[model samples]
Target: MGAADARLPVLEGGPLLRKAFPDHWSFLLGELALYSLLVLILTGVWLTLFFTPEMREVVYTGPYAPLRGVRMSAAFDSTLRISFDVRGGLLMRQAHHWAALVFVAAIGVHLLRIFFTGAFRRPRELNWVIGLTLFVVTLAEGFAGYSLPDDLLSGTGLRIAQGIMTSIPVVGTYVAFLVFGGAFPGHDIITRLYPVHILLLPGALIALLTVHLILVFHLKHTQWRGPGHTVRNAVGKPFFPQFTASSGGLSVAVAGVLVLLSALAQVNPVWNYGPYRPDLVSTGSQPDWYVGFLEGALRLVPAWETHVAGHTLMWNVLLPAVVLPALLFAVLYAYPFVEQRITGEWRDEQHFCDRPRERPVRTGLGVAGTVWYGVLLLAGGNDVIAQTFRISVNALTWVLRVALIVAPVLAFVVTRWLCRALTEAERHRLAEGVSTGEIRQNVTGGYESDHEPVTSFRPGAPRRQLTAARTGTPSRTPHEPEHPDR
Candidate 1:
């Protein structure tokens, strides 16, 4: 290594190996996303080998007795064959599906962590945009993959998608035609989506993921405020052995969890749903969890239309399906810039993470958005919920609609208030020090409790220590100063 480095001046590995990374659990969320994507790629390749994406009619003569001699699409037939005949094919398929779900979820949570902690400020804004783009691309990839089996549930989902596409004002029909190749349930959709799912989307994801990681390395990580930590210096484990070993173990653990889930939990049972029939609709048919918010939006919106100059405008479909998602993503993409503009903190780069309490408005906004999404997600399953609980679906819808508007406002106010309260409490703690749990008798028979001076208090140390103390192992003695250098 020394000889190679001496011969090739650019081959030096010391600086790269010595790079520091913060040791925090929240930082692992991004790693979870990356590792799950790896699992997805591996299992996707395995499933791709046995799967046929063609939509031509074929007889299901596989080992499954119930569907024997049933006429189905080649796509569905191949799916059955993979599930029943190919060794370990079912496991791979489930693992791929589970990994995809986990990948989307991990990216979402990682983005939330970034947002709430102010990690998306300043120099990291572009990376935030890239992260959002990754999320959007992954969603498209998932929907495409979900439809590849050409089963009844997927067919229903495609039907809704077709309706959504055709609801656009001027170009809706053309877009739908271009996507399905002619009309609804056209023969070419599966074949078309196959390449996109396997090739195009994955390629885009890999490229984006690579660039995201490069920026992370170049920009360095944001760290919490602590003793000996600063915007200019990162404090934690080095990349060579410490961070690398822990990260490798994490990757293995993610893979193992995915495998376990695949082995035990069945997902997307295409066989039960049967082949796609244009006229048939399955009961309680639902999309994957990530797609549920859109479904919920479609359900919650009222069916309203307008006629203008002999043209019909679909306010219901367009508002919920098209405009809502566009607005949501646009806000997400532009949030960092918007916040920078509002706070006038564009010139100085933020390397230290902000506590959620420190930025009450941002935290409240985050909570409000989350509540809105959660309500929509619940609304998506309104029918099932109504049926199970023996309630009126219309009534339930009305309640959710009201909540869709009111819940967010309430949540924002509550969250903002709580953040302020926590901030005030922290200030008091800083001023008075932590309670030492001891009382003494004064000379005049008055009783008072003694308090230890917090000589070495770090800005954010109290929150961390309080959290640790809740877990029953206080990191420091109450009698000792929280920090030796206040």
Candidate 2:
């Protein structure tokens, strides 16, 4: 070891091992995403060993009594076998699904943290684009895997996908043909998607994830603003013994949580849904949570079509699924540059994170975007909600449509006001010091609370330390005399 270290100086303990990362809880989000991906890969590899990706029609003779003798595709049959025949196979399948869900969710939340805190500025803009790309790729990967089961629910999802693809202007049919390998419910989809799900998309994810992490390390981790933290210096634990240990523990915790969820929760029960038949449709069917927004959008859009130059245009399918997601991702990709151009803060390199309250417009915009997404997600379940409440589905749809338009505006206004109010309150607190609970009589016979002078205050400091009082000084009115233990 000593000789190798001497021969390769890079192997020796140096600045890389001693690199400082902020000990903020929000920083753990990226680590959570990484760990979730690791769980996904491990469980996915296990499932792949027992699963066969085939579309040939076959009679199920599996141990599951309900599915026995049912005519189904080889893909669905293998899924049932995995669930019942192979020990611990169902657990791995559920874990893989849960891990994918968590992975997408973590990346989303991590991006929000970065955006709100202004961490995606200047030197980190490229990383922001890469992170957004990761999100898009992850969504695709998830949808691909979701459809591989060949069950009724997934087949319905694929049908919708095919319709969306066929809605494109001139090349729609060709694109659909290329993807499904012939037509809707073609024999080639499962076989084709198998490699993409397990190989192509995951490979792209790993490559992009590698580049993203390299950029993070090369650019240095962004730290919250505090006394010792600055553009030139980061104040936190070293990478080797401290951050490494904590991060390792966090990975274990994440894995344990996934396993626990897999054990407790049953997800994507293909037996219950039965095999996909193009003529039959399942009731109360919905896509995964990550794809819920698009589903919601499709449900909300009124059926409309136009004929231009003898070709029919499907505004309903085209707008909601294709155009909306495209615009959304485009805006996300261009936000950092657009913000820089708008604010004209072009030159400075920011390493210390900005407080959300300090930037009212950005905070408000972020909140508004979140509110918009939440509304869409809720809309995705309008059918279930309506049936449960015995309300008119049309009424609920109209309500959601109105909310989709007005709610975001209202959220923006309220969020901006609150941010401004918080900023002013913080400024006032810094200037006037904290109030003591003790009430004392003044010279005019009026009771008033005393103010305690804070000894130290800094942005991102602990709340307890923010109210710490100075030892020697007691703030009082000029008319009052100093008293000990009064």
Instruction: Give all candidates' CA lDDT scores.
Output: 0.88, 0.87
Taking the tens digit of each residue's C-alpha lDDT, what string does model 2 give over 1-486? 345546767756645777788899999999999999999999999999988899999999978887789999999999998898999989999999999999999999999999998889888999999999999999999999999989999999999999999999999999999999997889999999999999999999999999999998889998864444446767888887899999999999999999999999988888899999999878999899999999999989999999999888999999999999999999999999998777765466767677787778888899999999998998999999999999999999999999999999999999999988886677668658667788999999999988776654433333434424543332222222211110
Per-residue error for 330 in candidate 1, Å, reads 0.6
**lDDT at position 47, candidate 1:** 89
> Candidate 2 regions off by >4 Å?
1-8, 11-14, 434-486
Clashes of 1: 1
Lowest lDDT block of 10, candidate 1: 477-486
Which candidate has the top score in lDDT? 1
For each candidate, how many residue pairs have backbone atoms clashing (under 3 Å)?
1, 0
Candidate 1: clashing pairs of residues: 456-483
Tens digits of per-residue lDDT for model 1 on 268-295?
9988898999999888998999999999
lDDT score, residue 286, model 2? 84
